[model samples]
Target: EPEVTQTPSHQVTQMGQEVILRCVPISNHLYFYWYRQILGQKVEFLVSFYNNEISEKSEIFDDQFSVERPDGSNFTLKIRSTKLEDSAMYFCASSLLPTGSEAFFGQGTRLTVV
Candidate 1:
């Protein structure tokens, strides 16, 4: 079965630097999303993309965060001006339907802000 794949399983960056996390969702899935889990916290929704545009976003996805489907198969999340609180395991997910369906998730990219 095809699955979401994320690059650089572990990423370490300076507090003021920028980071771009990448993901390749399942080839046939139509909806894609970015979610993050702070060390011991619950998974939080960041944003969702469909039809090459942002479909939904949470407050957590402020100006500092952006998501893009730069091509037919790649989805990416960029965090500008990383902060200590930004350290977390960011997960990439895709689903055939926006709701009432299972969403496949990647292993996740652990972002560590120093």
Candidate 2:
């Protein structure tokens, strides 16, 4: 069995700086997504991608955020300017099934902005 993997398990950045979190999803999955969990909050969806285009995105994925599949095997999420509020654990997930199906998720990239 394969799993989604994210690089830089933990990161600390200064406010206003840029950060790009990287992920490699399960090879057979077709849909990819980015979600975030604040220190003690529930996970929230940020964006979803399918067939190389964005299928859906939440308000959190605003002008300050962007996601891309630069190559066939990797996906990345970038925050143009980090904010203290952006501190959270970001998870990358992928699914072979439909929208609500269970997906494989990465360990998460913890981002702390100060």
lDDT of each: 0.97, 0.95
**Best candidate according to lDDT:** 1
For residues 1-114, write the lDDT of model 1, one tens digit per residue: 799999979999999899999999999999999999999999999999999999999999999999999999999999989999999999999999999999999999999999
**Clashes found in each candidate (C-alpha, N, C closer than 3 A):** 0, 0
The alpha-carbon lDDT assigned to residue 71 of candidate 1 equals 91
lDDT of 2 by residue, 74-113 (tens): 9999999999999999999999975678888999999999
TM-scores of all models?
A: 0.98, 0.96
Q: What local lDDT score does residue 101 receive in model 1, on the 0 to 100 scale?
A: 98
TM-score of structure candidate 2 = 0.96
Q: Candidate 2: which pairs clash?
A: none
